[model samples]
Target: MGAFTRYATAGALVLASLPVAASARAASATAAPAVTGAARADVTVPEAWGTLIAAGRAGKRGIAFGDCPESEMLPESLRCGTFSVPVDYAHPFGPRIELAVSRRAATGDAAERQGALVYDPGGPGAASITFPLVGEWSAWRKTARAYDLVGYAPRGVAPSPALSCRRPEEAAGTPTDAPQQPSYAYKRERIVLARAYTDGCVRAAGPALRHYSSLDGARDLDVLRAALGEPRLTFMGTDQGAYVGALYATLFPSHVRRMVFDSPLDPDARRVGYRAGLARSRALESRFGDFLSWVARHDDVYGLGTTADAVRGHYDRLRAEVSRNPAGGTVGTAQLQAAFLNAAFYDDYWAMRASALAAYAQGDPEPLVTQASPRPYTAKGDENADAVRTAVECNDGVWPADWRVWDRDHTRAARQAPFAAWAGAWANLPCASWPRPRQDPLDVRTGRGALPPVLVLAAERDGVTPYAGAVELRRRLYGAVLVTERDAGSHGIGGADNACVNTHLETYLLTGRVPARDAECAPHREPNALALNRAVPRGTGPQHILRGDPAPAGS
Candidate 1:
C-alpha cells in the first residue's frame, strides 16, 4: 500500500457474482402507483423496520453513549459510543459485533436545528469517528452547526474489534531493487505477498472476514439511525463511502431525507473489477499528466524540466536509480511511485512533492522519505485499517479467481497508465485469494421515483473515484443533481475551499435545494507553496491537511 493506498486500492472485486437488488418496493398491492420525478407519497415503509426501531428506542438492545476517549484536538461536546449488531443480519441474535460511533450536536439555535447528518470518509477502511471534528474545523463548519454531525467506524475499523491480518513485526519486505521494466519475478513476488496477507487475515479474523461487505455496513447504518431516533438519514459519503450511502438509500429509500456523494464509485462497475480498475488507472494517468504540467510551469523552483516530457524523463531516471538501489535503504520504486501517486490526489501537495523529487534527484533522499512515511496507527485497532480495506473490498463482489486475468488486464492498463496500473493490480490482488466466499454486488440502481433528489459532487479530473463515477451515480439515483468542478482533479470536493462546489453543497445540506439541472463550477486556483502552507492547519500531516482535518490525532 502507498500514501494514497486507502483511495487507490478501491478497485472492484470479482465480476461473476450474482447481483443483489438493493431497491425498496411497496410491500402491499394496495400501495399507490410509483411517482415519477418528485418525492413519491406512495412508497410504504416496512412494518418490520418500524418494529426494529421501536425495539431500539425501548432500549432492549440499542446503542449506548458515553464519554469519548479524551483528545485535546476534539471538543468535549463530541460523544462517542458503540452498539451491537448481528454479524449476519439474518441471524439477528447470533454472533454480534460493535460499531463505534460519534456525534457532534447541532451548534445552531434549536429552532433551526436539522436532523443528524452522517458522513463516511471514502475508504472502505477510513475511520470516520473523527469526521465531525474535521467538519467543525473546515469549510463545513456551518453545516456542522446546523446539523448534528454523525460519524461511525464501520464494522472492522478501529475501536470496534477491528479486522487485523498481520502484526507490524510480521510485515513482509518488498524487493529493494527492480528492473527498468517489470519482470515475471516481480509479479510473482507481488502474488506471494498478496497470498500471505490474505492468509494472515483468514487466521486473524476467522469466519467473520466474510461479513465485512459494504452491504453489511449499510445495515449497521440503519441500526444507528434507529438508535438515534431519526426518522430519516441525511448523509454525505465520499469515495467508497459513496458506495455505502448509495446502497443505504437503495435499501431504505423512504428513510433518506437528503444525500450527497462526493467523488462517488461507479455502482454499475461493482461486478466488473477489472473494468473499474482500468478506469481508475486511466484517471490516474490523466491526473499525473496534470501534475507534470504543473511541475513544468514551476520549472524555476524545481529545475527538473521546462516541459512535461522532460520532467517525466527525470522521473523515469529517478525511479530507475531508486529501483537499482533503495534510497535510504527504504525508498524503493514502490515508495517513489506511492509518493507521486499521492501528490496526484491533491494539487496542494504539488510543490512539496516536486521539491522532494528534486531533492531526491540531487542525492538527498530524506525529504522524499518524509513524504512517503507510513501513517502511524493512532490506536491499537488502527492497525487493522488496511485489513478492513482488503476484507471489505474482497468480500464485496466476486473477483476473478485466475491470476492470468489480472495479469492480462493490468498489463494492458500499464501501457497507458504506467504510474498506477501495476501498483493498483498488486494492491487489489488479495481478492484473488480472499479466504471467504464472495458476496454478491448490490444492485445500486434505485427504483424509479423512490429516492429523493441527491446532490452529487465531483472533480472533472479526480483520479481516485473518477468523474465518470459521479455521472453514473446520477443516472442510478433518479432526480439526482450533479455539480462538477471543471478542470479540478482533487478527490474530495466538499469542504475543499472551492466556493462554487461548497455553495452548492451548503445550499443542499442547509435547505435541501438542488439545482434544476446539472451544474458546473470553475476550479479553484492551484495551490502554491506559500498559499498551501497558510491553508493547512497546524499539527496535521499532509494527508490530513488535504482531507480538511485540523489535527492528525483522531481517526
Candidate 2:
C-alpha cells in the first residue's frame, strides 16, 4: 500500500499446493509464431533501425546477439547480453535505450526444454539479473533446469540507464516518521518533502520518467520475447514482478504461453491505485495480531508478556521511550517499527524479531537498529532505485493529488497497522506531485479475450500483496487457478520451502498444466524456535545488516 518492502529475497520460496497437472509436455521449438511484435504492431519502424538491425544481426544470433558483461559474476553456463529498443514503442527507431538481459539455458534434455522463462523479481526496482542466485531458492531449481531462465533490468533501473537525481543524497532520503499520531507540522513536513522529491525526480529523470511504468516494462518484455525468437512469452513473476506479468497478459493476451503470477497485486483497473495500499494496511494489521499471539505464547522465552495486550504494551512503551530518547542515538520509533514489521511478513523471522524486541526492552536496542536502518539510499548506482519505484508507480496510476485524501486514509489505517501505514504513505508521498501524466489503471481480467490458463499463488497471511488481491486476480482471469499456503505469513510463497507448493509449481513449469480448481496447501514446518533464538546471540548488535525487503506495490 504505502511501499512494498524489498522482501522478495531469501524466504521467498514456492511450494506444492494445487495438484500437479495431469500431463506434461515439452515445448516445441517450432511452435507457430502467435503474433510477432504484436505489442508494437501498429507502429512503423523508423529508418534508423536499418543500420542497427544490420549490426545486431551480424553476429551468430541475429537480433539476439549478446555476450555476458565482464562485470557480472555468474555461472559459465549463463550468458548475458544487451539489446536496444525504442524508448517509446509507438515511435520505434526513435531514441533507443539498451536493456541488459541474462539467460540461463535450460538444463533439461534438449528435446524437453521449453521456451525461455523471463522472470521479473519484484521491486519494480530490484534487479532481475540476480536469477543466478535462484539456485539457492530450491523451489525454482527444477524451473531453472526446465526452461531457459531470462532476467532483465527493467528500464530506468541501474545498468539500464538508471535515473538518479543530481542531488542523489536528497533524492535517496527517506521519510522517518515514527509510528504515532502525526502533528500538523509533521503532516506539513511530509508534504514539503514530497514536493521536493517530485521536483528532484523530474530534474534527474527528465523525459525518461514517462517510459518507466509497468505498462512500458510489459511492452519491453514482448520486445525481448521477439528478440529471443520465442513464439509467446513464458514468465515467472513474484511481487511487483507479478504486476508487470499481469499487465503484459492483459495488453497482449495472445502472446502469453504460460505465466506464474505469485503474490500479485489486485488487478483493479484504476488510475492511482491507492486503495490497494489501504488493503495492504488492513492485511498488515491482521498479521500483526498473529505476531502478538505468537509472542504471547512464547512469553516464557521472550519474557515480554504472557498476554497479547501485555506484549503490545511492551512494544508501545519501547516506541515511546525511543521517541523521547532515540535508541543508540541512531534508532528511533520509526526504525523500530520498520525492523519489527519484518516479523509480520515472514513467520520464520518471528523469533529473531522477538529476540530483538526483548533485547530492546531490557535496554539494548542496537540489534533492532541494525535491522531497521534505512537502506543505504545513496549507494553507487542505487540512488535511482527509489526514484524509479516512484516514477513507475505514479505514472501507472493516479495517486490522489490532494493531501487531505492521503491524510484521511493514512490516519484511519495507522489506527490499526501503526507499524506500517504512515511509513508506507510517506514512502510513496512523491506520487502525489509526480509530474508525469497518469494512465488509467489497467483492467487485467482475461474474460474478454482468449488467454491460456495461468497460475496464481499466494500466502494466506501475506501483508505486502495481501491474499485478497490474489483472490481477486484468480476471479478476474477466467481460466486462472489460485493456490494458497495456509497460515504462511510470507510475501512470496512460490519461493518458500514448502514442498507441496514447489511440487505443484514444478508440475506447472515442466508441464503446461495447473490444477483444474483453486487449491490450498499447508505451510512448511517452521524452524526450531529454540534454535532460532539461540542463533540471535544475547546482548550483542547484529554482526551484519539485518535487511528486510519492503513489500512492493502492484505486484
Candidate 3:
C-alpha cells in the first residue's frame, strides 16, 4: 500500500508484554552519571513562550525544502531553500550535508518579529518540509507565525542525502519463515549477504553516515538556525524528533529560544546499548494488546476471533504456520508479522489490519507482498528504507555487537508475543552486522546555557516513546516539562489532534505555560466502531477518508 512501513511500526516482539520500549535511555557520554527514573517524577513548566528578550525581522522570502505540493505555492514572502551543514560538525570544511529546509515568515509588520519556530515530525525518518507551510493552524503556529516557521529533513532521510538500497535484492533473502526460508544453509548465505549490503553503505555513505547521530542531527538544526540569522531557535518536535530537540537544546543551550517536544524519547535510551531495545519491545506489546482486544470485539469486521485471547492465539498460529510453510512462496512469518506493524501507531490504521487479516484468511499473497516490500513498485523503487533507517537508528546507539543477545531475545519474544517477535528482529537486524563501527550515542545533557526550558508530551500507553521515557527526558533536560497524556495509546503527542492533549499543547505552544503540575490526559478510545466526527453525507465532505490529524486546533 505504501513504500516502507509506517513510522508507527508495532513492536514486532515481546508481549503485554512488560512494556519493552517506553523506558529506553540513550547511551551516556564518558563520565556523566545517568539519572534514575525517580528523579523524573517532578515535572517543570516554563514561563511565557516566545517572550522576546530581543527581536529580528525577515524579508518576504520563502525558503525551499523541495517544490511545494503542486497545490500550495506562495510568492516570495514564504519560500523554500536548502542549508549546507557540516556532515560532521567537527570537520566543517570537508564534506557538506544539505538539509532540505523551508520557512514561512510572520504575517505583517516585520519590525516586531519574534523568532524562528522549527519543527521535527518524528520518524528518525519522517518528513518535516511541509510542516511550516501547513503550520498556520497548529496550536503553536500562531506564536510560531509571530516569527518564521522552519522545517528540515534529517540527514539520510528524504530530501536530505536520502540513504537508499536501490532494489529489493539489495535487501536480500526471499520471504519465508526464518527457519524454513533460511534453513541452516540459508542462514550462512544471509550472513554473507547482510555483511556485503552493510559494507556497501560504508563505502557509499561517505562521511555523512557517521554524522547522522541525533547529536549531529541536532547540529544540522543549529545550522538551520544560523542560516536564518536568528539569535536563537524555537523548536517543535514530536515523537522521535523529541530526541533531536533534546540533543539540540542541550548542545546549543544558548542558541535555544523556546522548545516543545511532544512524545519524548529517552536521551539515555538513545545512547544506550541493545538491552533497552529489547525492553521496549515488551512495552510495545501492551499497546498492541489494546488493539487486539478491539479486533476481537469487532469479530464481524475481521473474523480473526471472538475474544482477545482467541485473537492472539489465531494470529500466533497463522504466523507460525507461515514460518513452517509460507502460504505461497512469497509470504513468510516475518513478512506476515511485519504487515501488522502499524498497529502500534494510530487506531485508524486498524482498517489496514483488518485488510491484512482478511487477506491472510483468504491465503492471498498480494497483501503480504505489499507490506513486505521495503520500498515501492515503480520502475525505480525506494531504497532509502535500508540506508536511512540503518544510518540513523544504528549509529544513534550501539546494538550489542553480539548475535547471541539478539538470538536469545528473539526467541523469548517469539514465545511471549508469538506474532511480532522474530519478524521485527529481521526487519532491523542488518544493523547487527553493519560494516561501520558504532558511534557511542550522546546522553545529551548540556544544561550549560540559557536555552528556555521545553514542554515534553507523551501518552502513558504509547509503546514507542513510552510514559517512562518522557519522564527520563525531563530529568536529563535542564528545564523541561513532562506533561503526560495519561491514558492515550500509540505514539501520540504533538502528533495528536485529540482535544485533551491539544489543549495542553496549545497552552504551552501559545505561551510557555505548561501545566503547573504534571498532568494526565483522558485515555483514547480505540478505533471508531462507528464514525466519530461530524457527519459527511457519505463521501461528501473532506473527500479523503483517512482521519485528519487528531490535534483539534491544528488538524
Candidate 4:
C-alpha cells in the first residue's frame, strides 16, 4: 500500500475504535473538566479498549517457573510467561502476538503487598524480560520486596515475535572517514543506506510495521494490567520507556494509581522529529565537554591531556585513526561513536571510557574493543533493537518527508555540536524513508488535576533524554512533582545508588506521599580514579551497574 493510503487506514482504524464522545472530548482538550481523585469516576475508557481488556483477562494464565536459554543468568526466583495481545489493537480479533513476561512475587506478607510494579528499562527495543532479575540488585530492591516486580519484553523483542531486518555483519556497515563537517556526498550516501534499510524492514514485516508504535505498546500495557487482575497500574519507566508510561496514563488516566518517569522523553519535542535529535545532540555536546574536562583533571592517571581542548584534540585523532583503521578489526568509527556516546548517559562511565581511550592511544585496542562490544540487551547484532527503535520513533510522529530537510538540519547541527550530531542523525535516518505513514502525535496534555500526582526524576545534565524533557513532562502531566538531581548527568536516575533520589522514590512508592513541592537533591560523588583503580576489579565497576549488566557475585 502507498504511504498516504496506509496513513488513512491507520488513522481510520484508531478513530473508529474510539467512542464518539471520548473522541470529541479528545479533540476539544478544554471540553473535559479537571478530573481530580474525587472526579476520577467520571473518566471513561473507550469501548474498544475495554473489550480488549476483558479479552485479555479471560485469556490470562498463570506464569510457569521453568528454565529457558536466557534465564540461566537470571535469578531462579523469577518466573516467565507470555501474555497474548493483538498485533493490531485497531483490529482486536486480528493476528495476535505474545509479549514475554517475567515476574517476581512480593517477598513481604500478603498485607504488605501493594500491587504489581510493571517496569520497562528505557529502550523502545530493549529486552526487559530480565528486569525483575536485575531489579534485585538495583534501587528497586525495596519496592520489589513490597510489590510483585513484573517485566515484559514489548512486542518485537526476543522471546516475542521479533523484527529482524539485517544480519549482524551487514548491519554494521563500514565506517566513514568523512570529516566532522561531512561532505554532501556523505549525506547522500547516508540517505541511500537509510532507504535500503527501510526497504528491508518493509519486506520483512509488511503490514504489521504500522502497529509497532508506542500507542500500541500503551494499549498492550492496559491488556497486561487486566491480565494481572490489577484494578490500577503502578509503573516505572526510563528513557523512551518513560514516553510509553506517559502515553499510557494519558490514555487510561483513571487506571493509573501511581507512576514514575526517569529521564523522560519530551512528548512535545518528540512530535517534531528533528527537534528531538537536535536536543539530544546539543545535550551530548554539553555533556561531552564535561567528560573532556573530567579527563583533563585526571591527566595524571589517563595522561591524555591536561585541558579540555587538548583532550578533545586527542579524541579527534583517535576518531580519525579508527575511521581509517577499525580497532581490533571491529571498533570502527561507528563502534567508536557508539562507545563514547554512552559516556553521555552516565557520569560513572567517564573513568572507564577515559581509560579505554588512553589504552587505545598506546596501541592496545582490546579494552576499547571490549568497551564497544554490543550490550546484552541489544546483543542480536543490535539489529532487532535498532529496527524496533526505528519503527516506534518513526511511527510515533511526523518526520520530515523530504531528505533535504534532514540534510540541512543535521548539517547545521554538526557544525555547532560535533560530538554525535551526524551519528544521531544517521541512527535515525531510516525514518526519512520509513515505509509506514506517520501518525499524529498523541495529545498527552490532560486537564488540570486529571490524575494523581506523578513522580519525575531527572539529572541536570542527562544527555540521553535530557533533563528538559522531564520538565516538559511535568508541565504536561498535571500535579507531577519533579525531583531534580542537581548537576548530575545520568540517564536513569533512581537506581544508580543516589541515596537522595532513592529516598524520595522509595518514599513515594511505599506511601503515596509526594513532596509538598518539587524538590532537588545533591549530585552523587564523582568517581575517584585513584581509589577506583586500587579497589575495583578488572571489568566490574559502576559501568556494568549503570549499563544494567549482570552484577558480579555478592553485588
Instruction: Estimate every model's Cα lDDT from 0 to 1.
Output: 0.70, 0.67, 0.56, 0.71
Clashing pairs in 4: none
Clashing residue pairs, candidate 1?
14-398, 14-399
Residue-level lDDT tens digits of model 4 in 32-106? 223234323323434344334334442345345455445335657877777677666555444567677878888
Ranking by lDDT: 4, 1, 2, 3
- What are the TM-scores, per candidate, against the unseen true structure? 0.85, 0.83, 0.75, 0.86
Ranking by TM-score: 4, 1, 2, 3
Worst 10 residues of 4 by lDDT: 1-10
Name the runs in model 3 displaced over 4 angstroms: 1-78, 105-113, 136-147, 165-190, 269-273, 320-331, 355-375, 378-382, 435-437, 446-450, 530-555
lDDT (Cα) of model 2: 0.67
- Model 2, span 425-521: residue lDDT tens: 9878888888746667766766644678899999888887888888988887768999899987667767566788877778888897999798889
Model 4's alpha-carbon lDDT is: 0.71
Give the Å shift of residue 341 in candidate 1: 1.5
Q: Whose lDDT is greatest here?
A: 4
As a whole number from 0 to 100, the lDDT of residue 539 in candidate 2 is 16
Against the correct fold, how does model 2 do in TM-score?
A: 0.83
Candidate 2 segments exceeding 4 Å error: 1-72, 75-77, 166-176, 374-382, 530-555
Candidate whose TM-score is highest: 4
